[model samples]
Target chain A: MSVKNLEELNPIQIDVLREIGNIGSGNAATSLSGMLSNTIDIGVPVVKTLEYEEVVDFLGGPENVVIGLLIRLSGDIKGMMMYILQSSFANVVLNTFYGKQLDDILNVDEMDKSAISEIGNIMAGSYVNAIAGLTGLTIDISPPSFCVDMVGAILSVPAIEFAQVGDRVIFIDDNFKISNDEIKSNMILIPEMESLSLLFNKLGVEI
Target chain B: MSKVINVGIADLNVALAPDILATYALGSCVGICLFDKTKSIGGLAHIMLPLSTEAANPSENKRRYADTGIAELLALMKSKGANIQAVVAKIAGGAQMFATNSSVFNIGERNVNAVKKVLESYKIPIIAEQTGENYGRTVFFDSSTGLMQVKSASKNIIVV
Candidate 1:
């Protein structure tokens, strides 16, 4: 009746998690659209079970540099959420909000860091709010932490944290599009196993 | 005419002469490279955690921790005709990529310290190291030359 590892989840359980991803990402997309005043399109969220080795390539490539915002979730859901953006897309946001353009993601200043962190916080809040409303679970999120590094390295944080429970992480992946630019941004939600079970119980799903 | 062998996270491999052993995007994970120049042999291990003793499951992959991963790497290199006595190590990619208030996330520093302890116990001198920064690193170890090239996004490539 309980699922300890990602591989133990059946198809029905997977579908339920996918539905949660859909609702959460839908709310995130709406909030992002309102912030930029642009129409946003979100792809159907996918729940993928990946090994730690494959986590790097899940974004794009291991060596590819990216801007990552990590938010830790507590209370009902204990896990991490990552907002990953490419350099070009980050530059677009910076230019749109502060009229500042960044030549490189690694060259981000403190002000730019704060801007990106705030954006991540808003998007994560929207997502958590939607999930909490649906499941009636009390969830609290920490302030977003910003980092610009290789996507492989950035994703390693979650991979290491969750490796003890299982060799694989079942993460929800959401892709977003703004205007005509099909920027490849990913929103990754990695809820802990206990939190996952709690979420499923709240949703009236048998794991 | 040398090929680059990619070592993924929680993995380890040994290479012959003229070939390069590479592990990409090492954040908190430590990539330990052991090179025997005389025989032109190199081995690399990309480890995520500090110790295997603290692992929740004993059946987990040995290459996921510094203590066991480095030991496995050395044993594999010796099997590949490497002189264990002549082997020196070059380590990179133990970085605190993000600033967090919680010390629980300070795994990067702990991993680096664990790697040092393992290598020292094995009597393998760490000739060069690039660690404890706020960025990710991709490392390439040349077996023929016993040189490790450390590359970062914002910094120039350095051969250690």
Candidate 2:
């Protein structure tokens, strides 16, 4: 069995991917909980196959400003992971770390950027570690590239980067909460076509 | 009460006078606004890639590439009473949102260049532009006045 594109993913294959997201985000949430020293909870992971136009609105609209951290995945499973920090989430982290809040999200200084990057690093590291452990695949991630921009612009990177293969994009949405604040940050994992096939094969799922 | 007509990513639309053509959050993608002052008609295209030739699936969608998208937009505007000789363009977006060492990630630059080349090929002069920065832009183009308002989160709004 073979899958031609992301849109061709079967129901069972989708379920497998959802489970992968579940395990990965669950591990990530635990790591975040330890780092923030707060009780972190995650909602059930959602996997959606969307068109390029729909991706922006799905991230709370195109004009929505966000902190975007991108990590390139190489080696066994090649692709990229994008971690978006919502303003509320960034505020929570900032208040916890330095007891300071950003005057404006767009004007975030280097220290704040570094802090956000570190959070992305730890969470994405744990997420990738969980996936790698489950599949026994060796994966390496590049240092995160950080940006403060509109959600539409941030998402354009992945949408254009993967446009060569297909028109549809598959994203796994993970919702996180620290105590009472519902931080709707998003972590998107987009794997290359060959890597997708390899992952399905390793998991005994027909592509 | 004029309305704002949104041209989404990989999409294009034409509007007559008194209406605004807008595209939000343009990162690496380029928004090409072609306006005919004589007719007060305008068209906008939000193109993702530089050229259609680079597309693996060339048949997918013409509006997603600079080459095909600009040509299609010109044709659309012309059909809606825009004079080809009077049509001028203003381009925006093509921002390097993420600072990376790899040239492969510089799609913003590529998109901007491709859009310029395509416009030149159609004999359309670019009247004004606010592009090639490390920030996302939301463009609101007024067909009546041929004014493009560029807005960003980190900077003051500029109209060109």
Task: Return the top candidate by lDDT.
Answer: 2
How closely does chain A match the true chain A in each prediction, as TM-score?
0.91, 0.94
Choose the strongest candidate by TM-score.
2
Each model's fnat?
A: 0.83, 0.79
**Chain B TM-score list for all models:** 0.96, 0.97
Output candidate 2 Cα RMSD.
Answer: 1.5
Q: Cα deviation of B106 in candidate 2 (Å)?
A: 0.6
Error of 1 at A165 (Å): 2.0
- Per residue, candidate 2 scores C-alpha lDDT tens digits across A1-207 of 556688888899888877777888888888889889999888987876777567667878998898999999999999988888888889999888898888778878899888889899987787788778879999999889999988998888888888776767667677888879887767777888899898888888876
Task: Please report, in order, the local distance difference test score of every candidate based on alpha carbons.
Answer: 0.85, 0.87
